[model samples]
Target: MNHSVDIVLPWVDEKEPGWRQRRIEYDQGKEIESTNIRFQCWDNLHLWFRSIEKCMPWINRIFLITCGHVPDFLNLDNPKLRFVRHDEYIPKEYLPTFNSNTIEMNIHRIKDLSENFILFSDDVFPLLPIEEEYYFKDDMVGDEAVENIISTGSFTKGLHEQRYAQVNNMFIINKYFKKREVQKKDWNKWYCEDYGDRLDRTRACVYWYDFPGFYDPHMANAMKKSTLARLWELEPDALDAGSRNKFRGASDVTQYLIRYWQICTGDFVPRRTQGKVFFPTIDTYKDVVDAINNKAYQMISFNENCTPDEFEIMKRDINASLEKLFPERSSFEK
Candidate 1:
């Protein structure tokens, strides 16, 4: 089966304009540029779009979650893209509580869509190619990670307890597994203090951290649809509650899920290392591109002394580091 991936771009309309322009100027140490805060917001969105374009070859579906003002170009004729507005999925009472309503909309979308798919945030761009083996692993869930999350009582303490929920950023879920049953089995009761004994008897496959941090940390997290469907079956009205109130921002759900996994599973997943490159802050996109071409990592700090030749050496070093880390995949000829 072809693995479907969901790219979630949750955005708000209130950000400062020309923020991107200013960021470029700040990075380049250029003269005072126009501070049209509204422009910055759009520019950032544009950048996100560019990043998405770069990742499109590997992804299957792109879900744009927004409160208001979706770019018309996106909605006009993209077959692979779907625009989900906040008002369409979220309840009226729970709307105002969230800083960005798109997150709630995303959750609702995930719940409604029966297909199994991988989810991603727009801020995160895939820098390297993804192999099929990374996603379809025999042991997607780590036992040690789950045990760590359980030990922390994530289900019984703090915001998790207050909201009676656990959140995750990227996870695999399908409609076949009866996750509702697992949710109803006391383990879902975030407020309950005695969940330890009950959890030991359950068969929940959850990994606390992203496995093989080498690629994308969000890539391998999976939950069978059967698992989530079971949870919903157990608590028919579980999604009806205003669960967003207990957290600070849109990422709370995923963050909580990570913590839950950690508490339940003691093993911490290591983040992958890619060769680091420097990003220069320049007044114009061309300057930024030039800096990248030259391999200037310190230019982001506005280092005027950096010469073009020095930047070249930096690029060579970065390539060398990549070669060391990924000898087999390294493109540099010996």
Candidate 2:
């Protein structure tokens, strides 16, 4: 906890009108990421800042990455907030990108960013107070290194979607690291009790000398700028390809690739999986509400898949719950 940690929150206010036009103009053919559901605002972003300010007040700074459109409610005057535009950090060639992966892959380029940071999406919200160790310990980041096989469904469409990125990440990871050797070097770390049942998952796949895939936690990502730079040093072309992708393509490696490098290299401290994820379909709408009301997990993520009407209803309920929990205007608010 002696070292400082920052939160990198990349947001999209597509409702701003300019975002859609910019996206359409840039739509050379990236269909997978051009869905409305992908950019929907739940109108609960204020609660996210409130949760951070109240729960993790010791946070050093908040780098709010935007596409030149800041949220009206955000306190631009706040000393802790640093507004970042896509062109500011991302290289000029990767400009006008619609790919979230494209945006994320360049975060290490953000100036004055901490060596240790958590990548928080607009969908993830902390429900409880968290210490710095919750993300990092010593020089290692906190994570559970559970392995998994990419399901057949992942390649069904043959499009380079997120699952495609997972395969691409492992492809590069295996190229750099021999699984048998890494597991042998960090045997205890790989087989730690913190992984619980997932240890068996890794055990099941141990026979393979190469990694198939890392479990996609669908939660916040803890990362380091130096590790990112290391990956760039190791494989500049792979990263450059990812960055040049105006929209996420199958060949484009993700930020998860960096995390995989960290894990395979044993740069992570063991941590128990501590968050819950809800797919916001009508079937699970009630479950999301119950979790919030119960204070179920330390944090939660809503993977949007519901219909427009269903989301409107879910959005209203989510706002109600968060507003009730954090009634006062946080310092991050105007």
Best by TM-score: 2
For model 2, the stretches where C-alpha displacement exceeds 4 angstroms are 33-35, 154-160
lDDT of 1 at 190: 25
Task: Please estimate how well model 2 matches the true structure, expressed as its whole-model Cα lDDT.
Answer: 0.84
Worst 10 residues of 2 by lDDT: 152-161
Write down the worst ten-residue block by lDDT for model 1: 208-217
Quantify all predictions' global Cα lDDT against the true fold: 0.36, 0.84
TM-score of each: 0.44, 0.96
Model 2 Cα lDDT, one tens digit per residue, 250-305: 66888788778889989899877688988878777878888888888998898878
The digit string of per-residue lDDT tens for model 1 on 27-71 reads 343222233221222223443444345434555556666654565
For model 2 the TM-score comes to 0.96
Candidate 1: count of backbone clashes, pairs at least 3 residues apart or interchain: 53
Listed per model in order, the count of residue pairs whose N, CA or C atoms clash below 3 Å is 53, 1
Model 1: lDDT equals 0.36
